[model samples]
Target: MQNTSHLLMIRPVKFSFNEQTAVNNAFQQNDTNNNVAEMAAREFDAFAQKLQANGVDVTIVEDTPEPYTPDSIFPNNWISFHEDGNIILYPMFAVNRRAERKPHVLKAIEKKFRIQNKIDLTALEANHQFLEGTGSMVLDRDHKIAYACLSPRTHMSALNNFAEKTGFTTVAFHANDRNGLPIYHTNVMMCVADQFVVVCMESITDENEKKLVRDAIHKTDKSIILISFHQMEHFAGNMLQVQNNRGEKLLIMSTQAYESLTADQIKILENYNRIIHSSLNTIETNGGGSARCMLAEVFLPVQQTQ
Candidate 1:
């Protein structure tokens, strides 16, 4: 299936602006007026309901309170479920995020879907290397390509390891934030969909690297929608393509990202799929993640009804 209607979202018990992640993620802001954790819960609830109402099969799980992992809501960072019955656990840069990986979550998922193999990359974190799953690498599943940008949170060794295990060819580049610091996550600057790739090509300053990435996308027959750095900062590239229960293609994003689009951009995207966005001001302001981060698509086969 090209699009997965099933999505996994973590209902945060203690969601707050993560200071550790903020060092690299410029999108986050610390707000004192808003009760951040409570606000996040409400936003999450609404987001989940919105998705469900749109005919998406949403699985909402409450985060365990004991660990106090604030960023646990972004489960796509620590784990990814593949259509091939493969589950990948990735290495996280933040120490607290490492705790987000829970065996119990896997157990919970296994009850609903079969897992044929498990690939663990968390051990690389011990060596101070990290690759925060989908956040770090945007998978072009149809083309067997992993589009990644090098950053502190995305180590080359870990990327290579993932490519080898997943049988994906990697198109890697260096991406920087406004101040020239490495962008925290690749998904923040680019998204690879089945027929198109949304990217901030200007962020890859080196001509050779930019050409390589452009060529890779071209080879896969994907039309490129390039965004400016300012637009990327607005979370324009952080979009996910999903399917509804009726198998209708929907493009999911934050309201901010939706508004950031130019009329032409929207027209281009509408040609491929329907747009679905929610106001995630609270989530994006404090969580440093948008709609793509909030959804961890579950590609495992549906379990038989007993």
Candidate 2:
């Protein structure tokens, strides 16, 4: 299946801004007066409810409070589940973020699906190289392509290694924000779905690189929906397309991101799938991620019961 009806979400116990990530992630803002954790929890619940209402099979797990994983809500940054029953663990740039990858979480998931083999790339962190799971690379699953933007959190070596392991062709490029700073995560600038791709063309400043990315998307036979850098700031490009139990396609995004889109853009997207948005202001404002980041699609095969 191109899109999965099953998804995994991590409910935050101590959701707050990460100082380590804030250094390069321009989207994050630290506000002292607000109760970030409380507000984030409310937002997470609402978002999960929204997904459920849209027919998504959301598996929500609460993060443990002991380790204080502030950005635990964004589970897509640490682990990715595959259809072939492979669970890949990624190396994170932040020290605290590494704690987000816990064995207990995998244990919880194993109760529902079969996890045949595991790939641990955490050893690369010792070399000061990191690849923050789906945050660093957006997979075009059907076409077997991995789109990655080079940054501190996404290195060439790591991308190549991931491709070698997963049998995905790597399309690497450098993407920058409006201010010319490298975009911290590839998913922040682009999202690849089954039938469409939403991207910030302006972020790929190099003309040759821009053409290469555009050409690659064309080869995938997906309709390209381009968002400007301004819209990208609102997390417009961070949207994800997924399927529900009824086999209906739904494009998910934050309310902030939905409000940023043009009427024409919305019309184009609606042609392919219904658009769903939930208010995630607190999480997006403080954690530097949105609806897509909170969801880790579960593609593992269900275990057969005799």
Clashes within 3 Å, all models in order: 0, 0
Span of 10 residues, lowest total lDDT, candidate 1: 102-111
Report the error of model 1 at residue 196, Å.
1.0
Query: Which candidate ranks first by lDDT, i.e. highest?
Result: 2
TM-score of each prediction: 0.97, 0.98
Q: List the residue pairs that clash in candidate 2.
A: none
Query: What digit string (tens of lDDT, one per residue) describes model 2 on residues 43-82?
Result: 8999999999889999888899978789889999999999
Writing each residue's lDDT as its tens digit, candidate 1 over 135-234 gives 9999888778888999989999999999989899998899887788788899999988778889999989889999999999899888999998888888
* C-alpha-based local distance difference test score of model 1: 0.89
| lDDT score for candidate 2 against the true structure | 0.91
CA lDDT, candidate 2, residue 99? 90
RMSD to the true structure for each prediction, in A, is 1.1, 0.9
